[model samples]
Target: MPETGDAAPDFTVPLANGDVDSFTLSERLEDEAPVVLAFFPGAFTGVCTDEMCTFQDRLAAFNDLDATVYGVSRDSPFALNEFRNQNGLEFGLLSDYNKDVIADYDIEMDFADLGVYGVAKRSVFVVNGDVEVTYAWVSDDPGVEPDYDEVEAAVEDAA
Candidate 1:
């Protein structure tokens, strides 16, 4: 897991909108705004749905903090589009289908377990524009979700 003060690894991935773009950790923090990068195992799962829905429901609070929220998973763009529409998600859910982002972040799961392969573990990273990781949470149990309050607090502190 990445600790506070460590530089965030920058990467670009395809979005559900079919646009290939890049997001650099340092560039994101340049405006002095914080960013919330939420990593989920996959789209359309019960836990993942609930977790993203939570973000959607509280989108205003996050916006009030002037933070940009990004949901990332190994699911393809098509799957992500369906998930976003079904959940009415307003934020961008990035598609990291190739697992490059996950590998760069070191969040890939073990292939031997549960027959699931090429998936990223549930985690969240709060990064500042300087590419520093202000806060991070990796779910101890893959099925569990991170505490939003904890994340919100971290964002507040970082802000």
Candidate 2:
């Protein structure tokens, strides 16, 4: 997985921005504002819903820090579209259905015991304008949610 201070690998995927479209990480990096990627396992679950709603609530704070947040998962763009609408989310959710972006970041989780594999572990990466990771947090237990304070702090520093 990308460590703090390492250059973040870039990828483009379909965005859940109430439309079927694409967003590129590297493209955002060029704009010189910090970007945040929140990697979740899937959509429409209890914990995932709560976590995303929290982001929805604190979106203004993130914008104030000049950080753009994107929630990511292996779900299809269709599913994420509903997830966004149901949660009233203001940020985009990137569809990593092919599992390439998580693999690139080396954060792919194995859930063989649960009969699933290559799903994303709950994690967050704060990538600065320079394409470097200012903060990284990966959870071993999928049920764990990321610390928003830490994430906000990283974005503040990068901004």
Number of the predicted model whose lDDT against the real structure is largest: 2
Q: What is the Å distance of residue 30 in model 1 from its true position?
A: 3.5
Tens-place lDDT digits, model 2, residues 1-159: 999989899898999899989888988777736988999998998888888899888889999887898999999999999999988998999999999999998888887988989989999999988889999999989999999988898899989
lDDT score for residue 18 of model 1: 36
Residue 23 miss distance in model 1 (angstroms): 4.5
Residue runs of model 1 more than 4 Å from their true location after superposition: 17-26, 111-114
The local distance difference test score of model 2 is 0.90
lDDT of each residue in 1-159, candidate 1, tens digit only:
677888888877766643445555456567746889999998988999999999998889888888878899998877887888888998888888889888888888854657888788899999976678999888757789899999888888877
Clashing pairs in 1: 29-129
